[model samples]
Target: METQEANTKKVVVEKKPLEKVCIICAKGSLEDVYATLVMANGAVMEGIETNVFFTFFGLDGITKKQMNRLHTATTGNPAMRMPGGIPFPTMLGGLPGVETAVSGMMRKQMEELDMPPVDEFLEMITAGGGTIYACKLAIDMFKLEKKDLSDEVEDIITIGQFYELCDGDRTQIIFT
Candidate 1:
């Protein structure tokens, strides 16, 4: 009898740790920016090389003028709900000053939870050795100069250069 059970071929690949994480932020909404910040900060804390690229409206997250004064999206947001989980009315969200008030309340809630503001969060990430970058194309499109960006921004580079930094086999590119 052929000893077929004695012959086996299998391949087991070793798992490799992440060497770097490149995060791309394309939206500037308060929630979107916070999501990117949380992910980048977490990766930095884990001792992984972290790089954040802010493009399109996401530039608002790093722009000196808008960073601290970001507002939560009120209109067209399906997740908006009342204190008791009642769906927030669409027309109510469009009312004047509603967004600002809601954003203020949200910020207050975040403060109570010890969540640092945008600027402070960026500082924390940088202090942990995470690098922040702005998209050159977006900067030019918005007619913004380098001085308009936060001090934490390492530089404004093109997508090509950003990809070069992401050249390692163990690197991951995440879009937030």
Candidate 2:
């Protein structure tokens, strides 16, 4: 009986390798936009087919009028800091020009590191073979047209369409 039990074969289940990724960018702030770009770019570098769908305020990252002018979220961002690396006080965020100042500082630091602006980042991601899409409902809600979006945008698609693009055994979806 013991020998018979030892003869039983163990079946192994292996997960499929990640072949595609769908990233959802839902915020418009500088940090959020950069996060999405970095991840999408990284996915492409890993030889994964990637798609980035921008919805809600995330549309700002792909909009021609706002792409390069995204602001930092000051009100509730605990990670926000000053040039000296001091934590930014929440109360100071309410002062006029404070948000702009912080945003300028962040932009300068990013520039020092040779990070591209939002528009350029989008261009880079697309050039690297990643696709960018805008949420159709979001476009309607924001009163935006195709002409108002960056040329990098592949299309404005519904959520169902986005899901369809992500439909695959080895596809992963990330919501930022």
Candidate 3:
């Protein structure tokens, strides 16, 4: 019995930690955009290989004309709070200019913490050995060319290609 237990213990394999992470950003809202950025940055900081694929409206976060001007999603966002510590009313979110105001407030708060803007964040991530990819289907659907994206975008690729990038024994895929 002791010999049999020893042989079974040798057959058990030790699991290794994740070595790579692939993040998919599919929403355009400020919160959604920041969530991807934070996770990708954190992964790179831990010496894990990181790649972020921006699809659908999330492409706005990497677009040159809209990167720094992205807006918050106030409607249906229960977590939103006003600057004065009051909860943001859902009805108020529909009023004209309310989204702009909320976006500005969110920007101000991020700035207060010395967080980089979207464009700068992309740069930082790329500089830290992370990669940014734009969805080819979204680019074609939106009639966007390569020039429409920020310079930090490493490539425009399909979902299949994105999967290939994450192909490995311990690659994690996260959708934001």
lDDT of each: 0.92, 0.92, 0.93
Query: Candidate 1: lDDT over CA atoms?
Result: 0.92
Sort by TM-score, top down from the best: 1, 3, 2
Runs of candidate 1 with Cα error greater than 4 angstroms are: 1-13
lDDT tens digits by residue: candidate 3, 1-176: 99999999988967798899999999988888999998998899899999999999999999999989999878898888887779989999989999998898889989899888999989989999999999999999999999999999999999999989998989999999
TM-score of every prediction relative to native: 0.91, 0.89, 0.89
By summed lDDT, the worst window of 10 consecutive residues in model 1 runs over 4-13
Winner on TM-score (1 vs 2): 1
At residue 24, candidate 3 shows an lDDT of 97
Candidate 3 TM-score, true structure as reference: 0.89
Per-residue lDDT value at 115 in model 1: 80
- Residue lDDT tens for model 2, 62-130: 999999988997878898777678988999997899898889888888989989998888898999999
Error of 2 at 34 (Å): 0.7
Clashing pairs in 3: none
Our model 1 lands, by Cα RMSD against the true structure, at 2.9
